[model samples]
Target: MDIRRLKEEIITYSQEIGIDKIGFTTADPFITLKGRLLRQRELNYQSGFEEPDIEKRTDPSLLFDEPASIISIALAYPSKMKTHVRGTKTDRRGIFSRSSWGDDYHIVLRNRLEKLEKFIVERYPDARCKSMVDTGELSDRAVAERAGIGWSGKNCSIITPEFGSYVYLGEMITNIPFEPDTPIEDQCGTCNKCLEACPTGALVQGGQINAKICISYLTQTKDFLPETYRSVIGNRLYGCDTCQMVCPYNKGMDFHFHPEFEPDPELAKPRLKPLLSISNKEFKNTFGKTAGAWRGKKPIQRNAILALGHFKDETAVGELEKVLKHDPRPVIRGTAAWALGKIGGKRVKEILSEALADERDPDVLEELEGALEKLNHETKA
Candidate 1:
């Protein structure tokens, strides 16, 4: 088999299958990424969503036997909603980030990789291939960078000249010795925009991020959000886009090349009040197809409550009161309690005063007391 001919065939087939971009690289250990991972661990900066075994993450040989090359693919997602769903002062909405707007990228990218794998196997039956998306041990960004898919940007995203940073990446490790592509040059010169735009200073330097403080990561956590960063998250329901939004490379970059990436305005920016009481079945039916639904409904519901507070929507007081009094989960109840304080009003104070009398959960009770204290201070002032 002429390896060059096979590589060209793969590239041609990739385009036919609607892959926005594809590249190749040798599967040598990612030496530089290994050091960065170690440093992240030392600083406790990791989001805990990463594959914990560092060795398995950086060494392709460990995942696939005698891996010779890695194939990286990117699919551009729409950066802007073609249709807008405007919000009123009484009925504010919460937003899922652009990455979660359309179909769950994991399912979409995995399907494309599986098709590629089948084509390779049909040609070379003995070929070994291992494919993965974001949840995979090997970092998708690292593989994309090494495969020459894009340059690693100051925001730690692979920013392609064609698609900017609004692309979903996946990779397949194979034993085929395809020639590697050249890595792109870093274009973020003397730009501190992403760092300065971070609400909680989560972007520590140009490329490194402290995920613990990041609104994107914090929104996914089931635990109560840390007090310092709750308000900083603003109305983001799942992820933050400040760093990507501020990048010069990503300016005016919007792609509608694929129908699968089109955003449903209502789901992408759903009404906050209705979300507070969304049934599990309703939540799944509305958002299940999107990437933001992976964490289930609680986190999204909690963030919606936080967003109500961020807007100081007095109309949400009724919904917030119901959550504080009736929600089964302590995290939801506690977060609602905090939000009510932030959106203080006579009704909110009365509801908190009533809930505090009967609230039994130690954590919920504490949150009620804190909310009451803040309300009292406001009344005094």
Candidate 2:
């Protein structure tokens, strides 16, 4: 079998199946990346979400027997919604980052990879392929960068010249010696836009990110969000895109090649108040198919509560009080108390006082006291 011809045929087939960009690289090992992961772990900058085993994450040898090459694919997602949805002063809406706008990218990319795998197997009869999306041990961005899919922008996303940073990445390990593609040169020289624009200063000077403080990571946590980030998080319900939005390369680069990634305006930017009281079934039906729902509805609802507080939507005062008074989860109840304080009204002090009387959880009690302090300060003024 002619390896070069097979690689060419695979590239042609990838395009036919809607893969926006595809690249190949040797599966030797990501030596440089392993060091970064170790340093990040030492500094405690790593989010607990990362695969615990560093060796499995960087060495492709552990992925399969004699892995000769790795194939990386990128699918462009829409940055803007077809029908814009903005929050009204009375009815606030929470925004989900562009990445989570459509059907779960994992499913979409897996389908593409599976199709490519079948095509290669039919031609070579001995093609051994192992495909993985973001959930896998191998870093999607690292693989995509080395495979020449795009340069690693300071925002830590694969910034393809054609698709910008708004792309979903996935890779497949194969036992084929496909010629490696050239990685893109870094184009963000002297561009401090993303670093300066990061609300939480999550981006380190060069390109490293302290995931602990990243708004995107904080939003996905299934507990009370840190107070320092709550205000900066604003109306973001799922992830933060400020870094990508401010990137020079990402400007005027929105591609809608795959309809699967198209955002549903209502779900992607839903009203903040409705989210607080949404039923489990309703949440699943609307957002389950989207990537943002992977952490379940609690985090989204908690973020929505924070968003309502950020907007200071007095109209939501009643709902905030209700959540504070009755939400079973301490995190939700505590966050609600904070929101009530942010959206103070005539009954705000009374509402918090009542919750405090009934609240037993130490964290919730502290939140109650903090809310009362905010209200007392306002009243004294």
Candidate 3:
């Protein structure tokens, strides 16, 4: 079998099947990434969501015997939604970052990889292939960087020349000696836009991100968000795109290559008030297909409440009062008190005092007291 022609065939088929970009690289250990990850762990900068096993992440040989090459594929997602949905002052909306705008890319990319795997298995009966998406042990960005899919950008995204940083990446490790594609030259020379634009300063420098503070990771966290980050989180319900939006390469880059990736404007930027009371069944049915829903509606609802406060939506006051007074989750109730404090009014002060007196949970009571004090101080001034 001619390996050169085989690679070309795979490329052609990938294009036909809706893969935006494909590249191959030798399956050598990612030595540099391991060192960086170790530094991240040492500094307590890691998000804790990543695969904890460092050895499994950097070495493909451990995942599969005699791995020859890694094939990386990228699918560009739309940056700008065609059908815009704006929110009214009374009904403010929160955004699910562009990455979560459509059906989960994990499923979409996995399907494409499975197709690629099938194609290879048919061609070479003995070929051994293992594919991974974002949840996998190996870093998708690292594989894509080595496979020439794109350069690992300053914001820690795989920035393809054709698609910028708004691309979903996946990879397949195989025991096929496919000639490796040349890695892209780092073109982000002297660009400080992403670093400057990061709300939490999560991008420590260049390609290194302290994920612990990244809005994307923070939004997914189940626990109460730190007070410092709450003010900076803005109206983002899931993920954060400030870094990519500020990228020069991402300018005018929007690809609607796959129908599954098309955004439902309502889901992408849903009304914040309606989300606050979204039932479990309703939330599942409406947002189940989107990537943002993976963390369930708790985080989204909490963010929505914060967004209401951020916008100072007086209309959300009653709903927030209900959440503060009666919600089953202590964290949600506590967050409601905080949001009410931000949307300060004499009514909000009264509401916080009432909730504080009635609250039994020590944590919720502490949040309520802080909110009441915040309001009381403002009232006196």
lDDT of 3 by residue, 1-381 (tens): 889999999999999899999999999999999999999999999999999999999999989899999999999999989999999998798899999988999999999999999999899898989999999999999999999989999999989999999999999999999999999999999999999999999999999889999999999998888999998999999999999999999999988888998999999999899898889999999999999999899999999988888888899999999999989999999999999999999888889988878889998998898988888898888
Per-residue CA lDDT of candidate 1, range 189-285, in tens? Answer: 8988998988999889988989888889999999898889888888899998888998888889999988877999999999899999999999999
For candidate 3, report its TM-score. Answer: 0.99
Task: Estimate every model's Cα lDDT from 0 to 1.
Answer: 0.92, 0.92, 0.93
Candidate 3: stretches off by over 4 Å: none
Candidate 1: residue pairs that collide: none
Candidate 2 ranges with C-alpha deviation above 4 Å? none
Worst 10 residues of 2 by lDDT: 78-87
TM-score of each: 0.98, 0.99, 0.99
lDDT of 2 by residue, 278-321 (tens): 88999999899999999999999999999898888889988888
Superposed model 1: Cα runs more than 4 Å off: none
